[model samples]
Target: VPQDEQDIAGQWRTFVENNRLDAVVCIAAALRRGVLDEAEASRYQRPAVNLHQPWELSGLGQLHEAAQNADRLVCFGGD
Candidate 1:
C-alpha cells in the first residue's frame, strides 16, 4: 500500500523541531492536508492549521488575526 501522505509527513515533525524549521509559511488547508514545509507538516498526523488554504503563505499577512491563530493547531479527527 502507498504510505499515507499525512502519516509520512507526520514523522517529519521531529526533524522540523530538532532543526527548528520555523521558516517559511504554509496555507492552512495545505497544512491540514499534511503538507509541511520541512517543519509543521512533518510534526503531527493532525494539521496545525486553523484557517483555509486560500489564504496561502504569500498573502497570510492579509489575514492578520487568522495568521496569529495559525499555530493554534488541531488534531486530526479519527473516522
Candidate 2:
C-alpha cells in the first residue's frame, strides 16, 4: 500500500478501536490494497461503504456511483 493509505488505515484503526464504531466507510482501493481488511469491517458486525472507483468516471464519479449502489443496497448518502 502507498504511504498515504497506510496513514489512513493507521488513523482509522485507532479511531475504530477507540470508539468501537459499528460501521466504516472507505474507498475500495484500500481494501484491494490490503490497507483495510475484513477483520476491521467485521469487528463490530457493522456495515461498510466500500466505495468503488471506476476508471470511466473521474471526479465525483465514484461518489455518484457509490450513492447509486447505496440506494440498491438500501444504504444512504449525502453530498
Candidate 3:
C-alpha cells in the first residue's frame, strides 16, 4: 500500500508524533520490509539501532496481534 519509503516514513513520523505506543519491534523474518532508517544502512553488523524512528513502530503489530487472536475470533472472522 505504501508507494515509497517516504510514505511509510511519513506515516511513522505522524504516528510517533500522535500515538501512545511504547516500543518498536521488527519481526526478524520481516524486518526487511522497509522502514529502514539511517543507522541500519550504516551499521555493518547490527540492526541499525541509531537511526530508528525516534518514537515509532517497526513492524505490523496488527497482523501479529491478529494471528495471536486467531483461535478466539468472532463469527465475522475478526477478534
Best by TM-score: 3
Q: Which pairs clash in the backbone of model 2?
A: none
TM-scores, all models, native as reference = 0.26, 0.26, 0.30
lDDT by residue (tens digit), candidate 2, 1-79: 6854568656656776677643434435455554434454575464763332211112346557766777564545666
How far out, in Å, is residue 77 in model 2?
A: 8.1
For each of the candidates, the C-alpha root-mean-square deviation to the true structure, in angstroms, is 13.8, 12.8, 8.1
lDDT of each: 0.49, 0.48, 0.53
True-vs-predicted CA distance for residue 48, candidate 1, Å? 11
**Candidate 3: where are CA atoms >4 Å away?**
1-6, 30-51, 55-79
Candidates 1 and 3 compared: the better one by lDDT is 3
Off by over 4 Å in 2: 1-6, 25-78
Write candidate 1's Cα lDDT for 1-79 as tens digits.
Answer: 2554456434555566667654234467565565554345445654454433222243356456555778764435668
Question: Candidates 2 and 3: which is better by TM-score?
Answer: 3
